[model samples]
Target: MIRIRKAETADAESLALIGEQTFRETFGAFNTKKDMDEYCTKNFGTRIQQNEIADKNKCTLFCESDNRIAGYVQINLNAAFGAVADTSQAEIQRFYIVKNLHGKGAAQALMNAALDTVRRLNIKHVWLGVWEKNLRAIAFYKKFGFEQIGEHVFLLGSDPQRDIILHKTF
Candidate 1:
């Protein structure tokens, strides 16, 4: 059985580890090793995880199976993206499942929790950005009724790549 719960302050290190592992496994092949290293270090560092755990309004939900964290989702209200304000929407900043648990429904469970939280918050919609090359993730989001809204270019240091901005009405 999998249990989904809000992440606690003590989960920062575990979250960082999962973030690093997931990023390296998923994006390592697409970008140069150096670029991937920099991206992971900056995004999944201890400090970032600490900050995330400290935010009460921005929820970080974890999926635990067999007493181990199998996946997590980070959601926020009043999201800011490149100067655009989405007051009535919640944004999924991150969602990841450990490689071993990919097809076992853990990801979907986590997503459902985040979506439910968004609805409870009375947000009209939920938005997220996925790398264009992450076909599996794009398909998963599509299955959840998220439609592509626009193209985004995320610059990781000097490397820039396109991402698809997807949204679903609550």
Candidate 2:
């Protein structure tokens, strides 16, 4: 059985593990080992995950199957990419699923929970930044009615990559 729930601080360690694993799996192929290691160590550590989980302006949701985390999504109500004109917007800061769960409904379930969180907050718009080269993620966002609004630079370690800013207005 699959279940979705709000992530708690206690789950930080597990979240960190999953976050690092999925991030490496998704981008390691296109990036250098040094860059991947730097980014993962700096951003996906347990302390970082705990801080994010404890942040009041952020909402983290986890999708679990058979008591193991399959994926997670993080939304930030207080931050937005400069491209978003609307101040009343929530940003989907991170959305990742295990590679094995790609064809399953874990991503969809996680996304649904994220949108529900946005609706509950009365946010007028929801936006996200996706790497320009990540075709699969771009397509998935488009399926959710997210349209490209602009572009921004995303720094992964020292590498500056372009990301398409996408938005979906309620």
Task: Give the TM-scores of the predictions, in the order they appear.
Answer: 0.92, 0.97
Top-scoring candidate (lDDT): 2
Write down the TM-score for model 2: 0.97
Candidate 1's TM-score = 0.92
Which residue runs of candidate 1 sit more than 4 Å off their true CA positions?
80-86
Give the lDDT of residue 70 in candidate 1: 84
Task: Please write out the lDDT profile of model 1 over residues 70-111, one tens digit for every residue.
Answer: 888989776845423556877898898888988898988988
Clashing pairs in 1: none
Highest-TM-score candidate:
2
Error of 2 at 8 (Å): 0.7
Model 1, CA-based lDDT: 0.85
